[model samples]
Target chain A: MSDAPREIDALIEMMARLPGLGPRSARRAVLYLIQKRSVLMAPLAQAMADVARTVRECANCGNIGTSDLCAICSSEKRATGEICVVEDVADLWAMERAGAFRGRYHVLGGTLSALDAVGPEELRIPRLIVRIAEENVTEVILALNATVDGQTTAHYIAEALEGTGVRITSLAQGVPIGGELDYLDDGTIGAALKARKSF
Target chain B: MSDAPREIDALIEMMARLPGLGPRSARRAVLYLIQKRSVLMAPLAQAMADVARTVRECANCGNIGTSDLCAICSSEKRATGEICVVEDVADLWAMERAGAFRGRYHVLGGTLSALDAVGPEELRIPRLIVRIAEENVTEVILALNATVDGQTTAHYIAEALEGTGVRITSLAQGVPIGGELDYLDDGTIGAALKARKSF
Candidate 1:
């Protein structure tokens, strides 16, 4: 009950629903937006409206975009016969930021969670299967998280694509770059040791 | 380098400028908004636009409102001759949430800061001075923060109203209701001890 006007309060409430913001931070953000109404708030509102009106899921890859196909999916140069599978659009964005993958991506929306009753149809796994033959994919890389649900999803996809003849690989498990051995968890340390490469 | 649409990228950049949000969190928030576009994002955009178009500072007290005078200033019942002076609109809102104060508030916008070259003229101090006489204020309660700048501005206001013949008081300093003695800082413990009241 900050006594802000109804519109401002509503904006703060919606902002609080965002992934990283709580009620307190939402209030701070709304205050900041009001303080810079013309320079920031108005433009932000316009941007949001534009995105809401135009943004849609990529019909081919399930990535977010302004058109039926995402930029990666539409780009001819990205048809490298390789498809990187991720559990969410955020991971796709992370891979793009890394700039290590020039191929297209498949966004699973989420991992397979048996407790949540999420099955193969709930994800983009079926679409991923169709894509392998349609695009003549030579490799399918599973880049899902290391969580239990993520591993279950990876294994399910691997088995699904077993007869498709496309090479299946998972992201290498190892200590992260700049990671210290002493601070590494036992599981990661063991994995890194087992997968040790020649200098 | 997230490779999101240009509009999304722009929105993320603006969102990152908000208090308590960085680039990574901004990305997460944007993705969340996109996911809940109809239920949350559209409404949030509309709310922001409405606030931006209508919201303005209360000319009398520097509080944010949709009208020239804020709700408190417009309400005859709130003219109790006891004006609470706070450093910002957020503080005024905090007091409102506490629901302890019946009188209206005077938001100074910010405290006088030597390093920042902020003086009485830069804030709403002059307007506050004028309000004391015009509103028949009998008491001015300094409810600013306990920071050096807040205290400095409070003292400066007290000195400025020397001949106004109005009673000037400040909020009491003591341990917070749920505060623990062991975790309390040295300065706070000292202040609480000095301001201790009979049980």
Candidate 2:
């Protein structure tokens, strides 16, 4: 939809395929890149190329890193007895940004969606089960999302690890910080009330 | 803030500098690229590098191209006598998408903004005047935006081209296609009413 050269047009098309960008924003991004070729575009291109060539999925967990094991998986400081299971690497990053969890993570890649025919094998669920015994994990934390599919996957994993002698838990459900009580959904309000404790 | 490698972090930082993206969205985009490295990321990197190395501004029109002249300026079929001036290449692309203008374009790069210290000399106004004499241009159509700075630039260009014997015009103001009367600003409505033609 532009008179830009074929390489630029191809760049825009690939950029539009990114998760958040559309064709219009992709065009704008490409124009911005061309305008700042030396300071921004060239470095971005190099960084992407370097990452594409070097970055790899962690063999132990599913987190991304430069080697077979991700930083967290390889780090000796991270607790081996507790494992936080999340739906995606993005969620693992979010958890790390909070800096509260000191344990390693298990990336499920995606939640179970029968409609999409995604099963336990399709995800890293079998790998997670193997890690429990191999790593001598004592606690399994289900940090999955609250959506229907996320909850379904959590339940399936809990049932699968039922006889493994490992304690299973999930993230506490309640009103989020800075969230107004009036604006929260009824389900969140109900869950927050049910989980309320004495001061 | 992620445990991802430095290359991934650098890519996310560069992406966050884009117009519409924030750190969170940039992180998401980087993660998406990592996931589709083979299919999308590698090609996007190559395209960016190629465009960065080859793309250059058109000497006559300031439009981006692989050579000294942009496609519009190089095309023999485009009418040289009528030049449609725009504030940016994005606007030129917008005009091309409309496919109504059969004439050539002159990209001004930016509007004259006294507040930002941008003047005619900083833009392509001088080159445009030179083109009028060199190319024997007969008409100059100011297709600038309707903003105050855009109009200021247009008026300045019109005054500068005085006694050049070239027909000077601007894009007509009117209610936009599929626009609602209630949603339009008073100035637009007034202009549309004043420019109303005999139908």
Candidate 3:
């Protein structure tokens, strides 16, 4: 079969490896880019190159930014003595989109997965303990996922900070504000029932 | 909100403009690329740049490749005096993937549409006519979509080529192979039944 040039085919293969795209979708995306080369493809290529050159993990928190320190880490106003620990940078961005937290964050990179051989040192766990004492942080919120590995990581961190004198908290377990009880899984229903409180 | 650095954010925005991607998917893709910088992202960026620098439309058939004449147009075996006409290059690629047709192709760019004010001059209808005589093409296959405008364009092309003595044809309408009859639309069912021949 007559295919696109080698460079175009290579691009499609790389794109198909992305999180949400497959081979078919990547082919469509590449064709669209080729068709709109002047208006879209050229600009996208330039943008990706620019980001590849500048974006880096923050030295303090692991948030992605152009400089060594991310914007949150560099800002003096975000030093609220509260550290929200998340498992991934995507979670950090989700929390930021909510716009309710003024304190800084500590991205763990990933949860402690025994199957994957991920441990405390593999993430930023030791850094979190150090930050709690050095920054005089009073609260360390374990905002990890509800999965087994997430809980294990949170528990590990909590146990490790036994004498650190910092308050530990987690996201409340309950039905989402607009969630229907009928659609919730059994685990979510049980957690919501156990954490029920007075109105 | 704590968005990524400006360049990273720009990259995500540009990615979101692709055919099958939205903002959420684009953000996830960007994060994946950043995480796999050395293995996947850098190579993808370079591939896109290389394609943007070299890929061009085939002057003869409108297929995308690295030179003025695409690979299909430059080949000798494909000059079989038959031309398959399609509305877009993606369709042309689809035909190539099927590996059933060995003749050359003529990409019309798009079908003629009165509502969109697309006339004969806007597409490659005149070019197809010129190629028929110059290339000694004996047959012209109309592979435009089964839409109203597609049919209109086909009829227009057939009439325009009436005096040229080339056999005109089109893709047949039918229940797709492995397609369940219950899920097909009425128009498809009607066409399939009407076109049914000796089993």
Docking quality level of the chain pair in candidate 1 = high
Worst 10 residues of 1 chain B by lDDT: B71-80
Arrange candidates by TM-score, highest first: which order? Answer: 2, 1, 3
After superposition, candidate 2 runs with Cα above 4 Å error: none
lDDT of 3 by residue, A153-176 (tens): 999999998888899999998899
User: Model 1: how many Å of interface RMSD?
Assistant: 0.8
- Predicted candidate 2 versus true structure: per-residue lDDT over A87-136, tens digit per residue: 99999988998999999999999999989999999889999999999999
Error of 3 at A100 (Å): 0.8
| After superposition, candidate 3 runs with Cα above 4 Å error | none
- lDDT of every predicted structure (CA atoms): 0.92, 0.93, 0.89
Docking class of 2: high
Error of 2 at B2 (Å): 2.4
lDDT of 2 by residue, B11-95 (tens): 9999999877889899999999999999998988998999999999999999999999988889999999999999998999999
Superposition TM-score, candidate 1 onto the true structure: 0.98
Candidate 1's C-alpha lDDT? 0.92
Model 1 alpha-carbon drift over 4 Å, by segment: none
Q: What's each prediction's clash count?
A: 0, 0, 0
For candidate 1, what's the RMSD? 1.0
**Best TM-score among the predictions, by candidate number:** 2
Expressed as tens digits, the lDDT of each residue in B81-173 for candidate 1 is: 999999888899899999899998999889999899999998888898899989899999999999998999999999999999999999998
